[model samples]
Target: MSKPVLIAGPTASGKSALALALAQKTGGVVINTDSMQVYRDLHIITARPTPDEEAVVPHRLYGHVDAAVNFSAGAWVTDAAKVLADARAQGRLPIFAGGSGLYFKALTRGLSAVPPIAAEVREDVRARLERDGVEALHAELAVRDPASADRLKPRDRTRIARALEVVEATGRSLTDWHREGLPPLLPPGEFAALFIAPERDALYARIDARFDAMLAGGALDEVASLASRNLDPLLPAMKAHGVPALIRHLKGEITREAAAETGRADTRHYAKRQFTWFRHQLPEFEWVMPGDARGWVASVIPGREANPESRDSGSGPSDHPGMTWS
Candidate 1:
């Protein structure tokens, strides 16, 4: 694998900007890892880079999905592998960038061997949950797979239901399949990845401000355009962070102001969750301030060495706080 610079951070953290800078410097391809940005009609709302910015540097996997399909991290990693392979074959660096933590994790650590649930099984589980309530499903899951149930909150219907549904359809617990040992996708030795850890209060302010800007920039109209297409509301694309609230506003179910406020709040909450996930699950990534893109990137990639202490023989980070400077 060719060395790829991963520019990751919370929402509104200038990850895309940093990625473009690195791409321009290194003749790389900027691959989108954000789950929302994959939705085709969500360019402005997902803040997909402008054409001029894209023209300055090649980008892959942004605004390419129809809202009807639920795009998964597993699917994203598969797509990203092709982009990375292409970039390497062309002797160009691959710039992996986005706020979606799962996509990045899948790219680095690989996903579990969980099969896609059959449509009927999925619909049946969803209907059962809706009819029987979260607690009922929670108890059932506890009886079936106590490990996953213990880890999940009883009210975290999104995941708890998924765990139960997987067990029901596959006749194997999701946790059991997870332990079945899937092979690495990229493996740790392949590339350099970074996680941008911004100060919390500042990140919140940026989140609120960006949501306002997104609204001013026709996020409502974008959602309206998507809604006009009549894509299933339950689809992952339609349920993107700001899409639901904006769609509600468009449907006259909520005032525009209320919708925007809820969207901003949701983004802020998601940013918090993203940080927690990265810090806890993937501590191997070098943490960097977004402002030092050029120097930090130069320090880690290829021949240049920034911090002698963190670098290894192959491309991997040390058990420390900065880039590997081989």
Candidate 2:
């Protein structure tokens, strides 16, 4: 059997198409590694694979989560472990793909074994964050868990609140929890990983074009539906690249054009960050330019022929009907 493949890159980098191609060749399962793509309510906005594409090959974890759930990397890791095991048991290669660097990191480098904070505790902390302001929480955390506070930026509302909640709910600092991290699901040498490096000008153009395409593809309607549900604004689904901007557009807070531009800009920025993150945090992944990615894959996997119909050389989005890159 071929080693499991981990295809990760910035959004719209065609990682999904590459994974699908590999799965077709190796009879593998395509596993989701993107955080936003997990939400059931964020199909168009998150650029999740379409029903038709998913029907072409077995996919795990895409759109399996509710928008309201505060899903985390740890939760994803847990889900992925099961999916990986099932794929192996069925004698299928495991193809992981997405732009979530943290998910990839957790999959390959282990994650802090912080137990789930109770819903009540999480809500209380979030409420306090809104009411007391992040600075106040930072001060409180400094007193209670100085190590965590010192490590976190004062303005980082999410991590600060999380650290405070962990301490409040478990009487342990996040630092202490980090010491007892869960081992990686795919440890070193067990997987062949690659980061698709796209040219900046071309990538930005694709990001811009894809944003408009998503708008034309009913992304606004999708966001409208999600916004009507009145989910917490801090929820991951609510904060998806296009969701917040489109929500503001729905509220008459911004024009649709402005919202689209904002979403495109945000996505572009996120793509840049993904490049930096994988370079620094997951250096184990071989960085290959998009045009060279297929060759890299064939070279790594050995003896697999390139799919004749898979026309995406990673210059942009895949034209393959069975693939949609997030």
Candidate 3:
């Protein structure tokens, strides 16, 4: 079985650069495992590899979807499987890189066979999510499936809503389906993995600086362009880190500074969660400083270089922090 090297870490930790260097040396194909970068319209805000970066290496699944469409973890996993198959078939090494931990988990361990909820079920859950707080929804979920509730916090609206939706739709608990035994697509020993970790203070600094850089690097303009489309304010794209604040700013409801502050705070919180996820959920990955990634690559990759075509664009599907939906 062919397995790819997976590189994951908190945002702005330089994981992407390491992946590039490793891919360049290994001749691997960079496949995006990030949910945000999949949307073609989110290029700048998502920090997709720029045109110059993509030109330097071969990248797959970058900007393949329209921003208007909502994408699920299941969809991302399906797309990722295809990307892996294609890369392997072409005799190319596959490099999976992203900040989305759930995506990685879903790919490595097949998702629970709990199928998608019916539309009616989804609407019912959504109504509950709106009328009652996520805590209340989670409380209901806890009553239905105590085991699942035990594993999740009350504020984890996305999972809580999903779990409840599944129970309502199929009369089965999400946790029970998980207990039904889903095996790993590639066994643990089949691949090498790395999680880039910058020092805490430094990581926060980088997150701040990166957000500022993103604003200066046309992220605001990207938001402006998206705002012009007049899409639903509740759409996933509209809710991305800087997108909501920018929308509020554009609506004259808040000052640019206020929006920036909120955006920065949100990003920081997200980075914190990411660090926690990599530390706890992905214990098997080698945790190394971004500066040490080249060494890890040298030790594990054995001199491989992905084609230069994919690196021209500094942005790709896997370039951003892909978050789950509410």
Candidate 4:
């Protein structure tokens, strides 16, 4: 089998389409590297691969976790390890695709060996965060784990609470845990990595349009169901690109148009961050334009002759409606 493929890009940059095409051509399994797409409640809001698209090929780690779980990159690694083993045992090439920089980083570069914090400790930190606020928590963290407090922003509720939880659960600071990290799963040379880089204006346009499309595609309803659960606001699923804004709309806190605009703007900003993160944090990824991605994949992937149709102006299999491999 050919080397596994790693596809990373900003939201709505067509990374999913390229991955689906490659998986179809190589009989590979597409594993989700996106953080939001893992939550079952975020299928629409997160632009996760639809059930129909998933039916076309093997997909792992999509919509498998509940919205209540504060799923971490470390948790994803544990889950991904099993999926990777299963793919290798079945002799299927593995294609990791998504825009999550941390997940991709954890896959290629080792992650810190932080043990899971006990549920009570996590709940206590979260409760204290709600009662005492993030600044107070940051102050506490500064007293407990000075390095982590200094490293993390004062208002970064998630990281601040996490660091406090680590210190509370284990006497060691997060910095000490980072000194010992788990090895990368794929390692260097085991996978061919590509970051789909679309032109800035074009990418922003697509992100705005995709956000509108997602809203029409029952994203608001999905968010409503999730909000009804009254899950912790700090949970990753609750913080998905459009989820918070849509939840506000559902609660009549904003107009539908206002919510859409906020969601679109948030997504656009996130896309910009994704580009920066992949460029600086994961420099090894060869950046390819969306239109050129198929050709690049065709050249790197083996087993079948490079499909000329992929290089043509004609359409190819789409991972979702309005998304296609160019």
Of candidate 1, the 10-residue stretch with the lowest lDDT total is: 310-319
The TM-scores of all predictions, comma-separated, are 0.85, 0.93, 0.83, 0.94
lDDT of 1 by residue, 27-84 (tens): 6678998999998888888888877777766789988777777677877877887887
lDDT digits (tens) for residues 181-214 of candidate 3: 5455556787888888878898787778878888
Ranked by TM-score, the better of candidates 2 and 4 is 4
Residues 1-326 of candidate 2 have per-residue lDDT tens digits of 77889999999888888887676666678999999999999999888877767866678999999999999999999999999999999878889999999999999999999999899998999998999899999999999999988899999987898899899999999989999999999999999999998888988998899899989999999999999999877778888998888899999999999999999999999999998999999999999888778878888888755343333333223533324332
Error of 4 at 126 (Å): 0.9
> Residue 116 CA error for candidate 1 (Å)?
2.1
Q: Weakest 10 consecutive residues, lDDT, candidate 3?
A: 317-326
What shift in Å separates residue 128 of candidate 3 from its native position after superposition?
A: 4.8
Off by over 4 Å in 4: 303-326
Residue 158, candidate 4: C-alpha displacement in angstroms: 1.0
- Which stretch of 10 consecutive residues in model 4 shows the poorest summed lDDT? 306-315
**What ranges in model 3 sit over 4 Å off?**
1-3, 131-156, 227-236, 303-326
Clashing pairs in 4: none
